[model samples]
Target chain A: MKKLINKPENFVDEMIEGIILAHPDMVRTPGEDKRIMVRADAPRKDRVGIVTGGGSGHLPLFKGYVGAGLCSAVAIGNVFSSPSSDQIFQATKAVDGGAGVLYLYGNYGGDVFNFDLAADLAELEDIETLTVLGRDDVASQPKERSADRRGVAGIIFAYKAAGAAAERGDSLKEVAAAAEDIIENTATMGIGLSPTILPTTGKASFDLPDGEMEIGIGIHGEPGIHRGALETADEVAERLMRPLVEDLGLSSGDRIAVLVNGMGATPLEELYVLYRKVHRIAEELGLTVEKRYVGEYATSLEMAGASLSLLKLDDERLALLNAPASSPFFREG
Target chain B: MKKLINKPENFVDEMIEGIILAHPDMVRTPGEDKRIMVRADAPRKDRVGIVTGGGSGHLPLFKGYVGAGLCSAVAIGNVFSSPSSDQIFQATKAVDGGAGVLYLYGNYGGDVFNFDLAADLAELEDIETLTVLGRDDVASQPKERSADRRGVAGIIFAYKAAGAAAERGDSLKEVAAAAEDIIENTATMGIGLSPTILPTTGKASFDLPDGEMEIGIGIHGEPGIHRGALETADEVAERLMRPLVEDLGLSSGDRIAVLVNGMGATPLEELYVLYRKVHRIAEELGLTVEKRYVGEYATSLEMAGASLSLLKLDDERLALLNAPASSPFFREG
Candidate 1:
């Protein structure tokens, strides 16, 4: 594929430079080796700072959420790769603000290890820190071990709850707990119809048959649990939602918020068809859909497929869901 | 330009069906004359109902914004064609819950005419209505007549502000006023690196040499104001932003929100490159970016280009921007 880029090796550096240039309203503090992205209007001291880090490729995922009422800073790594401990530490210190900082990220092995090391480094600088990992992909595990599932689009919901908590002066620990609560309540499962083309490779990370799809796929081009011929829109929605509903054990009279998110390449029309089926199924199950979203919330480059996420809502989760947030990807009061 | 669609005529209907099937949490009234998308839990009488309508191919433009705290109904027409007046009228009546309804859409001749006609039809049924048209594409018209410019990605910001206003229980007139204010304050310009494939023609809507771009193109394959060899990201950003900055007549010390939106095919990396240049120039011009978004907010199929939008903001626009909105395409609260 033809792309407008210089050297693939310098892609990330150039990307970071461009981010800083375009958002001078945002601050890019170069640390020892890494950079931290922060809102230009850094608030006064005494407010807990929100920090998130992750691999690149998911634009507006880690960095897009940086601003008031959202993440205070973002530490970005290479595509599908975790940022280094030093990078995380630099971002933590840069946005600490003296109150504390909460490091929120997806539950991936590399991320956990690096974030733990970064926490140790931050503590040496007298900066307190807390961490919360999103583990919301129900399809990654059987129903008996759903908590061990990988994190995906459901992390956006966690970001909002955590950002709202941080914006309201919650301590780092409290904010971390709140984010974890949201993550635990949320569950996601994705299907990939087409593979994403890695920027460096310029080749698809993986491939499936032209008229087939892989269910329970990972964002980094990992194989899904099941591969089948292309199904009708209703069948696709059912296949993706079955695990979430079964895992969440959503029963009659339960209230939930549903997100039918396109992986990347699926059109909005197809998403709505999926939504129609999912809504009917939810009603048949006696659940009330308090809120709904259908579109590309989290994507894997130009991959085709969709993910279904459900957050079992209670008063607290609902309140946080209703809290205001502003990010490049998602904006609200 | 290969797409996975089965038949040309079934593309829109099939896609809409897929969305509803996947997002059972959302509602799409099937067998209707027009495709009407609505939140599943709609009919909330307390909040002012927000609605938008437009042509298809621009995924998430008219359809993706249907959800809580955003547009309650989005009437989608055929690819690059306006929804009929009756179709838009039915959507308005379906979502109207007595508080009132605000018809917000892009500034295109067909859309304006149809949506206005829909408003007239709705009023005859005792449903209060108001209209706000987005006219943000500064490059579509000469500086002397910038208000006549076509709308593009900037309409997303208008949807956001109007959604927030409705969510806050602003009366129909109040929401309409807020949306109009956003339209007046916003300016946008786009450059096309590649043309989108029109499903009917099964070919690119327009063509450019491998190393060229067309600036100031509309979402529906409209001819651009200027075309030239492809330039560096910096040059492209300047070309798109200079007109917007000049047309808006922004003075030093102005605060604005920025949107760096892709026309489908451009990668986030390039968008960031453009954003960097746009941000630097804006900073040099003494503008403060209160918010920034970088992604495919309003796309034209798989076109390769980007648009830069600046919404000059005061306290009111800023507050409305910060308000909670929950749409499929954009949501935080």
Candidate 2:
């Protein structure tokens, strides 16, 4: 439970200040509302401005993704908490160009509600906007209702595709469409090895037996669909990927892009072991893994387990994925 | 001491398999060695061939830096153990183009030994070769002996600079020079809040009290220069950055790139708090932070705490850093 901080309440503010300090190249202009952060080089005119925002713990996710070829500005909230509506609106207004802006991010209750409200506020500002919510975690919901699945690391995939399209001068509608395409084809499921400590509580968000894992858990320590004894890497991969493959209706001859992502605590060595089995299974199932990524693209503090994400790829998806992209979380050719 | 591993001996192998499976776009030839990995799209003859390797566990460090605009190949060894000379030789040979190949990585004892051996072997094959080692951790040694500090996240900066230089058709010598320049100018020092769990032992790598931290540790759970009760983010920033700033010989009005890197386990919010204090202190000293990054760049499993890296930027370093680069560990325009 050891942490470096003066007080829990001051954690976010202090962290933002530190970020501004460390990279004077990047700006953290605290808006009238403190939740919004506008990059100093933002307000790129005539480009489809990209904006992403979410809770604070997932660094580089909502914030690190801000820069050229990715998000232009990001609105941040407290750890695991959603940004306020005004904060989202301020971010939107700060980055909006006459070309309009795309509101892209994970699909969460707070984010949905607040982003919707921000879109309305932007309308008042005469800034046209389109929202693309990422709900790619198939394990969060049954196949019949993947729309309800929580968003997770799979959002990094969306960011790459959407960032490339927007950077290429795609219209906001086109950018939103590209993101939705990525979301529709992607499915993710995660297990937790250790819980993240909330800054305020200084205790892990949840608890599990030392030898157990909770399958299909949310990034914020939400109760997973099932809890089971720790399993082998092969078993772990199967448990996480079975539903994804079936839910996506991936069959023989399908091409997929796989991501064996760490929840933060898991080592890359462990992720690679899982990747070994995942690749074998996919190949056996006749799926072609055209593009692959392994590492901690998205993290959940020091959670120990890993998640498996499969994106069924078409020619266009492959092209977009292979396209050059630059961001803190991911990069491409 | 909870870990998701089934067998200790199988940890590294399984992890490697998982990474290839996860990224079908990358390949590890079978029955060869655990350390060798290459882009699935091999024989990329037209482009410069980039290669790097080192011990395992420093995720996104050696392996994650493989992609367009970055290293084309990576060889991995056991956790914190350097890959064998044979393995390095194979990697150099696999990535060698008629134009030549560049060997870029950290300056760990094992890495230097093995890479030197590989260079000899590659020369026998008549393939041109150049080597660049990133030795930027400032606290590992004194200012007069800064070359002794272990390379840490600052290597990522090297990858960015060298990768961009190579991508831009720089000769192998130029790319090597760029990486070396980054290493020479970079200074880093780290603190650990906890220890990583080695899969084999199923135990923490090091020990620290619940409210204490170890400053100036290596990424492999090595002991730091001092151990003390954890302090506020502001104090933590000063503790980590003071040595790095002074080591770089930076004065007021100097522009530097700052990285508030998590060792693992440390939350982004806390990193940002560290960032705030770092910025304040740097500004007060009349230093300008031209660039900033905060996250788990080079992690030590799930150990907590963070490190600060300061690279005094001149036009040459800034231009190289600002160049477009793509790698799993870093991407920038």
Candidate 3:
């Protein structure tokens, strides 16, 4: 349980306080609870309010993306626990303008349920709201059951595209449609080499023997498709990319964006190694990689792993992806 | 040792290849060895060439900082080891425009010797070069002997300030002086909660028992001042900041830039917690924080720890610090 924390119970509160203090110009918490962080210049009239929320631990995901040209607000929760519907409603109300709000988040059951409840609550307040769930984890479900799959790193692309659209003064419906389009085209799969330690328990979330890896493990330590001996960087990248390419039906003529994301503990150097192989594989398959992002985008708490995500691109999506954007955790040309 | 690497010997080369591939537009390897990575738009005429290099494990350090308005080139070395003088010389030759080159790196014996040799080699080719060593780790030496201290995260400030100076067409002497100014005004200290396992050796670099921490631990596992039970985040920050303040002679009404850097495995969430306390302490000391950066600026492989760096800023240094800069790892407004 060696961590640079004072009390595990106060981790979330302290983390939020730290974020607000460090990035006063970028993010703010309207209420005293510090559970919902909104952009400093929120409630921009005529622009679709984009909101995303989820459990803590995966930093720069829900909170780090709250800035100009990104999500307008974020509802924060405990580690691996969904935020209460009240928190989500508060975030929606804080960022909602005349154009309405769009709730964008992963397809986790708890999140889906809570967000739905929040949307109902917002509607009662005369606020128009819509939802676009991200289900891009190929290993979580079969292609025919893709809607059942979990959302992983692919959600970043959704945030970028939909946020860009919203920043351009798109309607809530247009933002939701753009987000859904990205969700439909994106696919992600991860291989976990080590388990993350739960901050409260100071213990490993799950057991992973040394020299072994769990392919396709969920961010919350969910069991993967298979557990086996660790392979070379190329082999690991190949295995992770196979399911993603297949799930997206990628081919030689297809153009896409690639993200080699580290799951907390994996080093950027290793992620690049994985990306090198990913690029080679994409080239061999005749897929054109229009943009490549390699780093920790969405991460488990101190989990040693990496996830590969491919977002099949069209002109609109490509333009939005390439659009100028900057957040605490992500930036683009 | 659980790591996502193929072979220890191939780690450095493979990582370099991955960086070059992932950031082709930002970086490129000029020669076949792949040990020297230069900015894609390097050798800008009339601009002083800035170069930094070090071990391989620290991603985004020497390599991630190479870009426009940053270091013009970086020489890659193996994990925690200095690169050969030949490699440094090659990088110098690649990025040297009509103006001279400035060699900026941490203060380490091997690096000092090799960079010196490389500078001599470059001079034979009629290229003028100057060197500025960063020695900002307060824990590594006494105030009277600050120059003997080991350089740590504070070097990033040197890079930011000096790189900005060079990008603005400062002469080599001016850039070196700016870098030296940053090094003289900066102080840093780190605490290690867990040891990082070396990929090549498949073993921890040093032993750190559970529920304990080593204060002032060096990035490469050098012995610290004390080892004891882990303290609360506030207590730890207080201890780390006391020495830094003393070393820098910080006082009321001082303005400074604070960087709360993670040592690889520590989460950004936790870094924020540390930053919250750091901000409070700075306020209590009546010191105004002009700039703040919280995240992994420099890391020790996957070691679980955090380092705090404070750079006393003058108007010129503050402007340089806030200057627009972009690199694969760092970006600014």
Candidate 4:
């Protein structure tokens, strides 16, 4: 196991402790549970609250986005495991203002179960609540069952738009609608060059011989559509971007936001290389690249690969994306 | 050979192309050479200009730092190779305001030789220039020989302090002095869990048997002080942090800034894990960690490891650290 962790079980907690210590000015624990990270000035008098949570090991995914104009709180779980319903409830409670709360996170079985229970618990507290699942991983399901697809890095788009809606005092229904709108237009697909080694087990998530790549791989090593010898970055970019463009029914004159996110172990230089090709592909398709983000916005633990996400943008979505937002890992103006 | 790149020879240029395309608002090529990235608003009338450059592959180190309140320009080179004097001179000519320019970069032989030559060329053009070399990797040399040490991630401190000085309209001499002051008080140490694979050769920089690590390794895979079985995160942190604390002669009342930077392949989670222990160590030693930055501020092309940098801080240094800055890969306030 080539990891810089003290103990397998202590990994998630220790990582959280470090984040709290390093960014106390921006994030904090709402109460005794160290797993719940809330914005330092959370529970604003009347602003809508945004809560996101899922497994750990994906830095800047759930925990790293807690701040002004972003998530109000987050519930963290162990690596690749969902946060418990109780933990999720604690996060919802901590960030709940009188205006109501929104549960925004990726679409996964365990996460859906826990977050739903948390919503029920919130209702018992007389606090209004709404839920929006991010389901942008087109590789996980066909368009006929898009709601069943897994959510991946494209959820960052939903986060920005929904957070901005809430920041502007949008009602819970409107904020949830904003999230749903972005998630509907977003699409993401990834290619994995190597398997993630789970820290607890000290084992690879899956087995693949060297020099092979898995196309449309999920963050947790779920089966993908294809596995073959690795191709060049340009080929990989085309394969990933083509599906996203088609899935969104994008055409000439379409405006979109592009994100080339590095899986944990890929270098930033390689990511930019991929982005270069993706940009060229966009230009050839007569698409207008309104905004771009090329870095490790989301990741699997030490997995060597990258994911491409596209959000077909409209004026409202673009405006919200441009609105002022700040987090420990993300920022915009 | 599992890198996501196109042609090996085009790696650096392609990456530069992607950066310019993705962040056109913040950075641009000063001229026809894609290798020379400069702040979009360079040649700030009477303000001092700062130019930094080194080999490629270290994102956010050279190219990524070119922006407002950081570096005005950068001369890029291929991976692990110094840029040419001609490129450095181009950067100097592009950013030279009437107030003069400061050459702030790492203390590598090839880099120093080229930058010095560039300084000579700048003088011929009537552009006054001063130079400041970052030498903060304590493991590269003993305290008495610190002047000859290799500059590592600690140089980010110099970039911040010196960039802020230049932005505030200081002369080139004052900006160089500010950088020198910060570099003088800074110390850095790193450990490598794996070797970097050069894109061109598809060869590992060095070979280490599985489960062993190189302590105090340089970013480009230079020999370190120790090689042994990988230790737990805390032990490794103590090993790296102790030397920096001692090198800086930090006392109980001393205030300092901490940066736990990831060498490309290391996960952000692991960096935070390392930072947790470093923070604990600083507290135990009675040092006040007034500021903290934990991320991939410097990298070695997917090498799996991390480095810890410390800057002994005073009011002026802390103020500069807190000053507003922005780049494609870095941002501060």
For all predictions in the order shown, the interface RMSD in Å is: 4.2, 2.5, 1.1, 0.8
How does each model score on lDDT? 0.77, 0.78, 0.90, 0.92
Write the residue-wise lDDT of candidate 1 on A95-138 in tens digits. 87888888888888898899999999999999998887788877
* TM-scores for every predicted model: 0.75, 0.85, 0.99, 0.99
- DockQ for the candidates, in order: 0.25, 0.50, 0.78, 0.83
**What would the per-residue lDDT of candidate 1 be over residues B202-264, giving only the tens digit for each residue?**
787877776677888877767888887776666677788887787778989999899988777
Q: Model 4 over residues B58-80: C-alpha lDDT tens digits?
A: 98788989888899999979998
The TM-score that candidate 3 achieves is: 0.99
| Candidate 4: segments with Cα more than 4 A from true spot | none
Please provide, for model 3 over A1-333, each residue's C-alpha lDDT reduced to its tens digit, 9 standing for 90 to 100. 867787899999899899888888888887876999899988898899998999999987779999888899999799988999999999999998889999999999999999999999999999999999989888888889988988888999999999999989888889999999999999998999999898899989999998899999999888889899999988998899988888888888999999998888887878888888899899899998888898888989899998999999889999999888777777776
Index of the highest-lDDT prediction: 4
- C-alpha RMSD between model 2 and the true structure: 4.0
Query: Candidate 4, clashing residue pairs?
Result: none
Sorting all predicted structures by DockQ, with the top scorer first, yields 4, 3, 2, 1
